[model samples]
Target chain A: MSDLKKLGVEVLSMSVDSIYTHKIWQEEELSKMVEGGFPFPMLSDAGGKVGQVYGVYDEDAGVENRGRFIIDPDGVIQAIEILTPSVGRNDAELFRQVQAFQLVRASKGKEATPAAWQPGEPTLKPGPDLVGKVWQVWKPK
Target chain B: MGEEELDLGCARPTGGPVGVQPDQVPPEREGKSIEEVRKPMVSVGKKAPDFEAPAFYEGKFKKIKLSDYLGKWVVLYFYIRDFTFV
Candidate 1:
């Protein structure tokens, strides 16, 4: 989405819908009601094939529940979030995580960011000296 | 609920159904229920199952696959419906 654009990340949406239906929604509804039509592709699992694979497809509800999977560059899943239909997703946290994941991967797993880690902030280096003394040196903002 | 709903951190969903839905989903989908469909859940640290389906892109419908994004960080998200309040 536009929020992820600054972080150099792209998104893909999947649902138990048809491609044609998505086209119409993106054009008539999403574009008119929202700021922009989805910048990324929206996959339609009409038959619930991929949905069944991810367990997001609700066979009983006749819809796909909210599910998010953040896969790394190497095709490894780094994070996962699933929510019910009533609740919406937190795009702010999702954007922050994308940055964190990228930073960790850039460090070749040598550095790990603590929770609520923001960009340009100091990342933790796993070692003995930082084990028990983390609180002593880490300056929480 | 209206005032509190406005305080939600997430963005409000816009638009209602446009007369047409995702395409008429077959009533008997492989004769499977939620329990049967979710029997095997995808776990982390495992290779994501690669599958292909029709995706809307550039104002056209085309087939897209998970493998197409093998080299980039992908955030694959799924939501309920485009129009519903959810």
Candidate 2:
């Protein structure tokens, strides 16, 4: 998230705990992260209302699942990655998707980014003509 | 492409458009582990559901709503607990 902040992206962390729990955790653990302190607001979804909205609430455990959502500027979900509790999220991959999505969005339906596309890397142009010749222009990285 | 592809604060992928009821998962499964949680209702390319929650920000607890942020990209992520065994 510290890296993403450089790209002008805002990060909001959520948990099913309360403000007090987050305060203590932020002070003792999150503040000691590799990037220094967690550079974002942490939301306390006390009643799991937002959690259920996010499909991350585990009704049985009364906790949440590890879910990541990338929302566009227009209030739409552009990407979704949900994982189990023991799995950690790939922060770098999240950054990649965010960059790719922004690039495609700026193209205004003219360009399509292929898998593992990085910034400044070539993106594909979607059209009937370019259908069968995908290998002709896009080289695998 | 999903709105999750965008960087805005929204729910993650599940299926076509995120307009389902929040608690579609039955409440009877509370004792199960996190791994058994039902699949998400929201997915890529869907309208993210708006919600309100108490967020700890700026040294205080504030009521933050998904609708509160408009015209900006948001990356909303949820973790199981605070200071847990990851």
Candidate 3:
């Protein structure tokens, strides 16, 4: 989370569970998993009103499914991931996405990150000349 | 349909092509667009819907708003329920 913060990202987690449940879960379950519990806010979206907007709520089940959205500073969503309960999200991938988004925004769409691109890695410049020649510039290792 | 049969992008079993045969139209969903029947999915490149809700933070209950984090990248995620594994 500190790494996300360093990139100017704020994480807000929400669920249909009540605040009391959040408190209990954070104190008992999360605290044991992460030191001092979560550094970000755990929101209670009772009745799934907020989830309904994001398309994660299951009205029949009265619960929200797993969903994540990466919203840029302009309040526009940059990415959306909706998964079933059986799968867990990868924190490293999430962090990498945030870093990639930051770099893309900084470049104003002039540069694009390749698959699994990390900081200081080469970024592709999208143009007609670069087309069909990407293999010459980027080789997966 | 049972929950297990619910696939993410599967066409409604009231089958045939997406144009929908009149006889197979689900009564309640008749005349409704796919977007209306399904949950309102916010797509990328669209404005993130703003919401204000009570939040638990630092052992305290505080109201948090999505717009409050404007001018900063926001990782807004929704999980199934509390007390579940990550």
Give the TM-score, chain B only, in order for the candidates: 0.51, 0.51, 0.53
Kept native contacts, as fractions per model, are 0.74, 0.79, 0.87
| lDDT tens readout by residue for model 2, A1-141 | 777888767777888787668878878887777445677777777757667767888889999899889998887999988898988888889989989888888888799989788888888999998989999988887
Comparing 2 with 3 on DockQ, the higher-scoring candidate is: 2
Q: Can you write out model 3's per-residue Cα lDDT over A43-136, one digit (the tens) per residue? A: 8788676787788988888888889899999989999999988899897999888888999999999999998798889999999989999998
User: Which whole-number lDDT from 0 to 100 does residue A74 have in model 3?
Assistant: 96
In model 3, the runs with Cα more than 4 Å from the true position are B1-38
Highest DockQ against the true fold, candidate: 2
Cα deviation at A127, candidate 2, in Å, is 1.4
Q: Residue by residue across B1-86, what tens digits does model 1's lDDT show?
A: 00111122343222111111233324654566644533444778877767665577877656566766787888988888766655
Give fnat for candidate 3: 0.87
Global fold similarity of model 1 (TM-score): 0.79
| Ten contiguous residues minimizing lDDT sum, candidate 1 chain A | A44-53
User: Model 1: residues >4 Å from true position, as ranges?
Assistant: A34-36, A139-141, B1-38
Better by lDDT, candidate 3 or 1:
3
Candidate 1 lDDT at B67 equals: 65
Instruction: Estimate how well candidate 3 is docked, as a DockQ score.
Output: 0.35
